[model samples]
Target: MHLHCYSWTGAGDDLRREGERRPPLPPGDLAAFRASPLPPMRTCDWLLKPATRIDTSPPTVTEAQTWLADRYGTAEPSFLHPADEARIGLDLRLKIAEESLAGGTDVLWGIWLKAGGFICLVVVCCSPNRHADYPCPCRLTSP
Candidate 1:
């Protein structure tokens, strides 16, 4: 399947492919995050703000894993079915909430996966500006 990325700032949608330039991240203060014992984390801004909201009814682990596989054509054996909300940092959650309130994104739709000794987020994102949905996969590491 052909994959694409989009810039969705509530403005016109600009579509691009994997080798092309990436879309700009919505307004957010990732630097505002205070120091912590965890190693430095890395991820694009779009991952924090999913274009679509997650379902109210939690998906089973198997369902989440299947979704991951279907979207990416592969799924990690350690993929966590439902997200471990408690694993996310409080400060980060606050930042995401603030950004969402500012209309930066709809919500965070994510699942957890264990990579080696670290835990990461495998999230889904799309272009809010266009009718077409381009699902993108991103990883977010947490303390």
Candidate 2:
């Protein structure tokens, strides 16, 4: 969906050429946030808002282990999946840690192996399968 508000028209867009700095954030939280090691966060301008969402169902720990090992070389037993709404994709960090292939890929792909070693590419997630959360126990539980 696209918004065709007056902002997209010539008049409002021209204001971009004369963009003004936004007022600084309120002091109460500003100092505390700035003191943190995390990257600075900022609000988006109304001129160009992002699409509502870019979601992928969280991958299973088993899948993450392979991708992480194939990339990070040390995903250890499994990833401690973050608990958050955005859940920023950590695949890029995995890439940085991996020894690159002879031919770099825009996207890394892989297959899932069955117990007998029969395998299939994970083209899409099939439901109602779901990954278990951390501290979930050493045993496997079918979703």
Please report the candidate that would top lDDT against the real structure. 1
lDDT by residue for model 2 (49-108), tens: 111211122244334335444432322122233232115344554443232221221122
Off by over 4 Å in 1: 1-89, 97-102, 105-115, 127-143
Cα deviation of 2, candidate 2, in Å: 31
Give the runs in model 2 whose Cα sits over 4 Å from its true position. 1-57, 74-143
RMSD of each: 15.5, 20.9
* TM-score, cand. 2 vs. native: 0.16
Give the Cα lDDT of each candidate.
0.31, 0.24
Clashing pairs in 2: none
Error of 1 at 40 (Å): 18
